[model samples]
Target: MSVRLGRIGYLNVLPIYHPLETGILPMDCEVTSGPPAELNKLMDADKLDVSSCSSVEYARHADKYYLIPDIAIGSRGPVQSVLLLSRRPVEELDGRTILVSAQTHTSAALLRVLQAKLWNIKTVFTTGSATDVLGTGERPQAILCIGDEALNLRYHPDYPHRIDLGEAWRELTGLPFIFGVWIASRESWRQNREKVEEAARLLLAGKNWGTDNIGDVCVMASEESCLNYDEMCSYFDGLVYDLGPEEQEGMRAFYKSLVETGIIDEAPELVFLP
Candidate 1:
């Protein structure tokens, strides 16, 4: 049987999956793209055998999944696509309303963690368009935007407090934040482990090639994200594209915090691929 792979169609992620898109992988896998959180829901419902999932989803379903390595959408600092645009500095947001995009739970929760843990900010989220946060006489003090929305909004010159939340996470933890990871369902791993591993190898090689030829990758990403060449390059370079010890630490910390705050149902154990 062919595998169904759910991929993220974001600019920061596009380069990493170019090879797969070009049909380089050996396995007979179909790639369907969507928001990370949405993909997680599909994976849970068994609509996908493997997906590039929000790392938080892996934590939420730790008992039944394992992370495949070599390719990931991670950032060492300042992922321009995941941002918190505010009128005031992060440390000063208290009792303020923050606009949140309805799409991504991980990005929203990242902002919350920064507010509650690092900035000591007391904030509430109002679900709405990111543009609405630009203060039409009365706007939220800050706005949380992720994925394509964040990429689109970053071009505006008006956001005086445009802060990269991924950069902030690095400052707070000295580690790379793994925004997403590739996961294989337990049953699929047991059934088609060799093909899955081969596909992973191709995915990694493709990303490595993309990185080496960053100029082409940048152009492609720019077109994909509707960003100018410079903006696309900046955001693309911010991502780390691999699973390292530091990124794992950041993922674990985020999971632990979510569990402690009762956001996650339970603290699920980590499972690594062989």
Candidate 2:
């Protein structure tokens, strides 16, 4: 079988994948695009060879995949995309219900960690459609939204308690927040390591080219969203796409928090593609 690659079906990934889309890194392989959760499921089921996979999903099944070296979808601060839109301040939401988007695992887990470690309060999280939940005359103290939806809802005046999960994470741990990563499934890697390495090389080239010309990327990306050129530029500015030593440290901190919260029996070590 040819190498099967997966990409997040969100504009946030354009910085890297845009180059691929523009034929900058031409590779003769099939690339599937979908939401992060769906891609994670595909990776878990051995259906995807490589993917821009969810950070949480890798932790959930680390033995199945190898992290692509020096690549990530993360932010140092104010990631404008993963947000907690709240009716009340975060600290004040103790014992209150928060509606979570059905599309994410990383941000949801991050919220749990923040509540337990940063805010020093507990809040109940329920996963559902916001409109459907509210239609039942239920009022949640907050709602978690990720990707384009979060960007669109971030500025609503009614949500005075808006918190960018990335920014909050920086305040809590003083490190970058990794949302997703490029990974090669070990199943496929064991069968065809050469193909996996080729895919990784092309992806890294795309990442380098795209980040160097964010202006061009912003223009292309702006045309796809409600955001204007400047807004799109700023949004891209808030995102970091590299996984250096510091980024790895940030991941470790996040895993440590997960350990403290008993989300996992222990934090799995991040095994990268060699």
Candidate 3:
């Protein structure tokens, strides 16, 4: 049976997937690329054997998936791509409608956590494309945009109050924020342990190679995305790929915050492959 891999179609994930996409880590597997929300659904449905999915998704479905050790898309501060664009201050958003991006899951949840725990402001939330909300002249009072779309909005002068979620999380919890991780269904790993192991090795290797060759990766990423070479380098520079002990502590803090706010029933234990 062929192993299916899900690739997050965002520049933030370039470092982790560059080698795999550029044929450096050759493996015989089927790959699908889409936004985090799409990949999250695919992985939950067991459509992809192993994929980078929202970090919160792993906590939500802990029993169904196991994390591939030492690989993730995270940030110590100011992720640049995950932004909350508002007409007014975050404190003034109470009872106001905020348009959320359709391309994310973790960022959306993080927005809720911030609203409830940090800002103490409750607002009406709706989902739509950022272009429709910001470009169509029917802009909401507050909007949440993630991935390349958020980066594009940085040039727009109308959004004066831009809140970086990663930065906000760091200020609140004093730890790195893990956005996504490599996850595989328990059943798929049980049936194809070797394939999964090979895939994990290639992934970690790809991450290592990308980290060493970031200048090259940034050039290619700049051509494909809206960011320039320097901007891409700056963006990638802020991202953290290694799921080390400090990152784990950050995730645990995030999970605990989610639970404290009643966003999730409990903080699920993170299980990793041997």
TM-scores of the models, in the order given = 0.88, 0.95, 0.97
Judged by lDDT relative to the true structure, which candidate is superior, 2 or 3?
A: 3
Runs off by more than 4 Å, candidate 2: 131-139
Give me the runs in candidate 3 sitting further than 4 Å from their true place: none
What tens digits encode model 2's per-residue C-alpha lDDT throughout 105-135? 8999999999998899888888886656655
Off by over 4 Å in 1: 24-27, 131-139, 155-158, 223-226
Best-performing candidate as measured by TM-score: 3
Worst 10 residues of 2 by lDDT: 130-139
lDDT of 1 by residue, 1-274 (tens): 6678888867666676776677653446777888877898998887887888887788778777878866678788888888888777877778878888776778877777777677877788888767664646555677788888887777566567988989888887887888888888887778888766665666677678778778888887676557789977777778788777777777888887786666787766667777
lDDT of 3 by residue, 1-274 (tens): 7689999998887877778776887877899999999999999888999999998899899999999999999899999999999888889889999899888889988998988888999988899998875566876787899988889896677778999999999988889999999988899999999999889898999899999999999998889788889989999999999999999999999999899888899999989986
Give the candidate order by descending TM-score: 3, 2, 1
Cα misplacement distance, residue 149 of candidate 3 (Å):
0.4
> All candidates' lDDT scores?
0.77, 0.88, 0.89
Q: Evaluated with lDDT, which candidate comes out highest?
A: 3
Model 3's number of clashes is 0
